[model samples]
Target chain A: GIQVEQSPPDLILQEGANSTLRCNFSDSVNNLQWFHQNPWGQLINLFYIPSGTKQNGRLSATTVATERYSLLYISSSQTTDSGVYFCAVLGGTYKYIFGTGTRLKVLA
Target chain B: SQTIHQWPATLVQPVGSPLSLECTVEGTSNPNLYWYRQAAGRGLQLLFYSVGIGQISSEVPQNLSASRPQDRQFILSSKKLLLSDSGFYLCAWSEIAGSREQYFGPGTRLTVT
Candidate 1:
């Protein structure tokens, strides 16, 4: 069994601010992804960075396999980014174990 | 273009009642399907997954069951629901197995009363 831990379970940011979220896994992972669960409960895929770095718009993510951790960075945050951010790793048995999520509230 | 569909945005059922949730994918073939449940403000928990029709693997031992009648269709069923069954159910699909990014459906919210 693999365990995932997300730091700072709760977060609040102001518009135009910057923030970073971290995810640590207990074991090796073949796949990793970040998702944003909107207020409507829709799980929207954010990034699929198992290793290396990727950037989409004002968001970026990096995963270090050896370290067994990933970091998601948000720059110039917007109100639409206000939601629960989830980090999931595809580990043993090909199942994804999601983190508790970091609830982000961006105040305008 | 690929898309996942999950039905019945919301449901309220009684204990011991039968439960069925349907998920279908469009414009994709031989995709791996999975079922996950999430408690209020919590993480997603893997329920089951199928790589092909009539093939299923359960992760957690529970009252839940899953079936795939078509390459693009997946169904989750339960013979008897429990109060703990109340949660948000999400159906997801990926191109292949193990390590592929999953595309999730809108999700189904169920409340076992």
Candidate 2:
């Protein structure tokens, strides 16, 4: 089983601000995904970046597979972004391990 | 387009009661299905996964069990619920081709009194 750790367990930002979240895995992973669990408890897929970088609107993610780390960037944050951000990875099995998550609060 | 569904948006039951949660996927075949639990202010924990009909793999040894009687249906059951079983249960599915990205269902919020 691989270990997943997310940094900055909690974050608060003003509207239109920017922030970054990091995830570190203990070993090699064949799959990595970023998810946003909104206030309504719906887990929305953000990115499926096993490696390299990807962007969708004001959100972008970069995965350095060789370094066993990934970063998620949110620019011009909105109040709608207030929720939990999760990083999950699949390593050597069908099971996906998730980090404790980063809780974000964007104040309007 | 593939869509996952979960029923009983919320549930409240007494301790020792039997529990059953259902998940179904549409527009896909032979997809991989998974069950996860998220406790309050906590992370997601893998409970069970199925690659096909009648093929279930439990990640954690608990009172909970899962079954896949059909290709697109998954069921999570508990003979007797515990107070600790109160949490948000989610069902997810991914492609059978080994892709890691998974689409999650709306989730069910269960509370055991």
Candidate 3:
């Protein structure tokens, strides 16, 4: 089983601020996704990048599979962005392993 | 686009009670279904997963069982619930033997008092 580790377990930012979240996996991954679990607890998929970079609105993610790590960038953060961001990965095995998550708080 | 549906957005039950949570996926057939539990302020825990109807694999040893009666229907059940079972349960699906990007359904928040 592969282990996933996320950096900055907790983060606080002012509105319009920028931040970076990192995820490192212990093994190669065939699948990787970034999810934003809002205050209401719905896991909203942000990106499904196994490799390369993808951008959606103010958020962007890059996965360097060769390096076994991924980075999620949040720019111009809004109050609505306040919640937990999770990184989940499907390694060589079919199952997924999730990081503990990076809790973000945006102060307006 | 594929859509996943989970029932009973929230539930409160006493210890030792029976539990059943249902999940179904649409716009796709023979998808791989999964059941996950997320404790308060915690990450998702894989409880069980199914590749197809009548095929299930348990990830953790817990008081839970999952069944897939149809190509797109997955059910998570527990004969006797424990207080420890209280958590947010999520159901997700992906194409059969295909992609890894899973589509998740709104989770069920279970509280065992």
Candidate 4:
């Protein structure tokens, strides 16, 4: 089984600031995705990057499969961005291993 | 566009009670379905997944079981619930062919007392 670890277990930022979260896996992965869990407990899909970089609005992600790590960037953060961010990876099985998550708090 | 649905947005049950949560996906066929659990203030844990009708895989052993009787419907059931079973359950779906970008349902919060 592959292990997924996320750095900065907790993060707090003022609105309009920027932040980067990291995810490291112990093995090669076929699929990797970023998600933001809102206060209401809904997992919102942010990006699906297996081995490249992609941007969506104020957020972007990059995955280096060979290095077994991924980065998620948040630009111009907002108060609404307060929640937990999770990185999940699917290695050689149908299951997706999730990181411990980065709890983000964007203050007003 | 594909949409995944989960029923009983919230539930509260006593220990040893039976449990069943339903998830259905629309606007797609032969999609892969998955069930995940998230403890209070914790990350998501894969419980089960289905690649197709009647095909299921369990990621971890637990008091829970899943079934995919139909192509787009996945169900999580437990004959006896434990206090530790209280958590938020999420359902997700991904395409079978092109990519594995999983889309999740709103989720169901279960509290076993």
What does DockQ give for each predicted structure?
A: 0.81, 0.89, 0.79, 0.88
Candidate 3 residue-wise lDDT at B67: 94
**Model 4: per-residue Cα lDDT over B1-113, one tens digit each:** 78999999999999999999999999999998999999999988889999999999998899999999999999999999999999999999998867778999999999999
| Model 2, span B1-113: residue lDDT tens | 89999988899999999999999999999999999999999999999999989999988899999999999999999999999999999999998785757999999999999
- A80 in model 3: Cα distance from truth in Å? 0.7
What does the lDDT read for residue B53 in candidate 3?
89
The true-versus-predicted C-alpha distance at residue B14 of model 2, in Å, is: 0.8
In order of listing, the candidates' clash counts read 0, 0, 0, 0
lDDT of 2 by residue, A38-68 (tens): 9889999999999999999999999999999
lDDT of 1 by residue, B14-104 (tens): 9999999999999988998999999998889999988888999998999999999989999999999999999999999998754578999
Q: In model 2, where do residues sit more than 4 Å from their true spots?
A: none
Looking at candidate 3, what is the lDDT of residue A107? 100
Best by lDDT: 2
Ranked candidates (DockQ, high to low): 2, 4, 1, 3
Evaluating just chain A, the predictions reach TM-scores of 0.97, 0.98, 0.97, 0.98
Measured with C-alpha atoms, the lDDT of residue A25 in candidate 3 is: 94
- Model 4: which residue pairs collide? none
Candidate 4 chain A, which ten residues in sequence have the lowest lDDT sum?
Answer: A88-97
**Candidate scoring better on lDDT of 1 and 4:** 4
- Pairwise lDDT winner, candidates 2 and 4: 2
